[model samples]
Target chain A: MVLEVRDINTSYGDVQILRDLSLKVEAGEVLCMLGRNGAGKTTALKAIMGLVRPRSGSISLDGVELTAMPAHKVPKQGIAYVPQGRRLFSELSVAENIEIGLMARGKGRDTRDRVLNLFPVLNERMKQRSGTLSGGEQQMLAMARALCLEPKVLLLDEPTEGLMPSMIAAIRDSVTELRAQGVAIILVEQRVDAVLPVADRVAFIENGRTRDTVDVETLHGDLSLVHKYVGVGH
Target chain B: MDFGPYLFLAVLEGTVTAAVLALTALGLSLVFGVMRIVNVAHGEFFMLGAVLAWWFSSMVSGSPAIGFLVAIVMAPLVVGAIAVLCERTVLKRINYDPEATIVATIGILYIIQQLALTFYGADARPVQAPVNFRVVFPWFGYSGYKLVVIAASAVLLLATWFVLTRTRFGLIMRATQFDSETAQAFAIPVDRVYAVVFAIGAMLAATAAVLIVPIQQAHYLMGGDPLLLSFIVVIIGGLGSIFGTVVAAIIIGISDGVISVFFTPTLAKILATLLVALVLVLRPQGLFGKTPR
Candidate 1:
């Protein structure tokens, strides 16, 4: 396994969020987290990224302890997070945003060029302010910024929210491409049908606990699992 | 005797005031923009700069010019270091919460002011201008050092702009300013960035204080006016915009100079205060500040 998160419990003040959540993803694997709203899926990602410290349990990447590391240092350790709502530096130019990501890893223009190739739409708007980009373009730029890290593990929080089917397909294709290159991905997605094409496994979370971890084929055979955990039919 | 010479003189004086005010207000703006904290003690940093300049210049026995040069370089560095200390010890400890920072900085303001009073005394001491010359206008003569102050301020402003817009560190600062959380996710050490930014802001204020100390005497309470004026400029310019801060400084500075020449200094301050009230009522975001989406 490339990344292992074991029995992590996290809370915001008195209100507990994630309780005993556990999952693992190997290199070249895509682990999709399925849950209803407020099921602690995003909190799980934040715990891994060290944005929100887990109250207990272990997070290890390649057998290196990460639970105690600060949030800023997590990116340097080859874990990149594209947060919910596509938190691009809205006032900054597209080029500057990419530069910030590249700067994190001390990567050069070569890495920038490669990342830009993944989202060619960004190249034309290099000098344009990111806030002016359309919703789809903003999502692409957010992904591009994270990709600049060339991270071993990529955590995407709802990458396809409010996008057209075409843009959704584009995102799935990028995930597929990253998986092909042996990058471990933890995708927090709401739609079961949208995740099946790229996800190798699905971990259902409910009220801060991992309800089940099943293979894509297993979930396919048991569509009711999605209805049970997500409270929606595919 | 006529309106021509009076107008020219007022404009000249206004330009000098604007130059110094821009540097001071830019410092305030940067701290607010990045850290989202209102530094009530910012003026104390200015006061400390002026007092330190006096101390440094007094230590040297050579040409007044040499002493002035030493004061200019040493004062800002010393003030910048103090600011870093403050950020790490007080501001960082408080987590830079807007309300807490305001109260903490107010406490810092009194501490620094009292320290200066105890050490530097209550006297308003003057430093000699590095260059003692006058620019003779057809209508009247003006201080050559004042012109130098204006030119030097321009260079510093340009340098600051270059650092904010062109350099990689500048990119990190802008990124942090826009969204510090995301900047952290990208591996930008935001706490360190806050420390550096606080230092830079203090350095800018100190530089302004050093430049003005030769023209205006260095007094323990001199920080009060600059601090108040900087708040007016920052508010009118919108909170975090460097360009707005500079532009607002010019407007307030020039208006204060011209109005004081025509009428009274007290009236000039009243007018500027009224202008701020107007800006706040109508364009709360500032002239150049983008409206929140």
Candidate 2:
């Protein structure tokens, strides 16, 4: 397992959000997590990123424990997260946004050119403030910013939410490209059908627990398992 | 006597006030900008710097130049260290909560003030100017040291602008300022950055104090005016806006200098307060501050 989350319990204040939640992902595989709003999908991703501290659990990447690490230190451990809503630094320019990832690791500008090649739009809008970008452009910039980290695993939360169909296809294509290069991906997506095509395995999370895990090959023939865990026709 | 020289003098004096005020208030704006906590004790840091400068200069039994130079370097470092300590011990413990940090900083202000009162004594001490020269104008002579203060402040402010806009460090500070949680997700240590910013903010005020100590006597209670003026400037310029703070400082400083010379100092202060009130009523975001999104 490239990433393994074992029996994690997390809470916000007195309210528990995740109870004994566990999941796993392998290198170069896409694990798409599907669930309704308020399901523990985002929470699980946050826990792995160490944004929310899990009270008791063991999160490891390639046998290295990451549960006790700080949120800022997680990316250095080879995991990058593209949070929901494209949280770009609005005041900063697009170049600065991408530069921040490289700056964090104290690396030079080698990866910047490569990432810019991946998203030429970001390069075109390099000097523009990120807030001025369109929603689709911002989403692309967010993914490009995370890719600057050159992580072994990428955690994307609703990468296609509120985007147009063409933008959604753009994101899906980017996911496929990254997957081909052997980066493990934990995609927390709401559009089940859109991600199903690229997903290697689909994990259905309901009420803070994993309901079922079905291979996309198995899911392609019949989505009965997905329907059972997700909804009547999801 | 010709009125032109007097007017020139007033402008010159105001220029000095604005220079120092810019340095002092930049600290306040920076602390407010990144931490979102109004450092109530900010003025105390200014007071502490002047006090330290006085102490360090007095301790050196040498040329006034050497002693003053040592004080200039030592004072800000000491104050910056104290600020870092304060952030780690007090503000960090409170999680930099907007409300809680205010009260915490107020407590810090009192503690620092009282400590100075006890050790530094109640007497206001003056440090001798390191350089003694006058820029002889056609009508009147101006102290060269004052010109040095003004020039130094301009350079420092420019340096600050350069750091904020041009450097990678500035990029990180801005990223952290924009969204600390997201910055952290990108592997930027937000807490460490906050501590450094707090120290730099305090250091700027301390640097201002060290520069001004020769002109004004160092007293435990002298922090009031700088604090008040800085707050006025920050509010008028817009909270956390560095360029705005500098611009506001000049306006307030020159007005304070001119009005105080022509009219009364009290009127100048009253007018500044009125300006702040007007800005607040008309444009609450401040002249240079971005509207909260």
Highest DockQ among the candidates is held by which one?
1
Q: How does model 2 score by TM-score?
A: 0.97
TM-score of each: 0.99, 0.97
Distance from true location, Cα of B173 in model 1, Å: 0.6
Reference A-B contact fraction recovered by candidate 1: 0.83
lDDT of 1 by residue, A1-234 (tens): 479999999999999999889999999999999999999999999899888899899999999899999889999989999999999999999999999989999999889999999999998999999999999999999999999999999999999999999999999999999999999999999889888899999999999999999999987667888999998655
Q: CAPRI verdict on model 2? A: high
- Native-to-model Cα distance after best TM-score fit, residue B28 in candidate 2, in Å: 0.8
Candidate maximizing lDDT: 1
Q: What is the TM-score of chain A in candidate 2?
A: 0.96
Candidate 2 runs further than 4 Å off: A225-234
Best by TM-score: 1
lDDT of 1 by residue, B1-293 (tens): 79988998998898999999999999999999988899999999999999999999999998999999999999999999999999999999999999999999999999999999999999999988899999998877889999999999999999999999999999999999989888989999999999999999999999999999999999999999999999999999997899999999999999989998899989989999999999999999998787876
Instruction: Name the runs in model 1 displaced over 4 angstroms.
Output: none
- iRMS of each prediction: 0.7, 0.9
For model 1, the interface Cα RMSD in angstroms equals 0.7
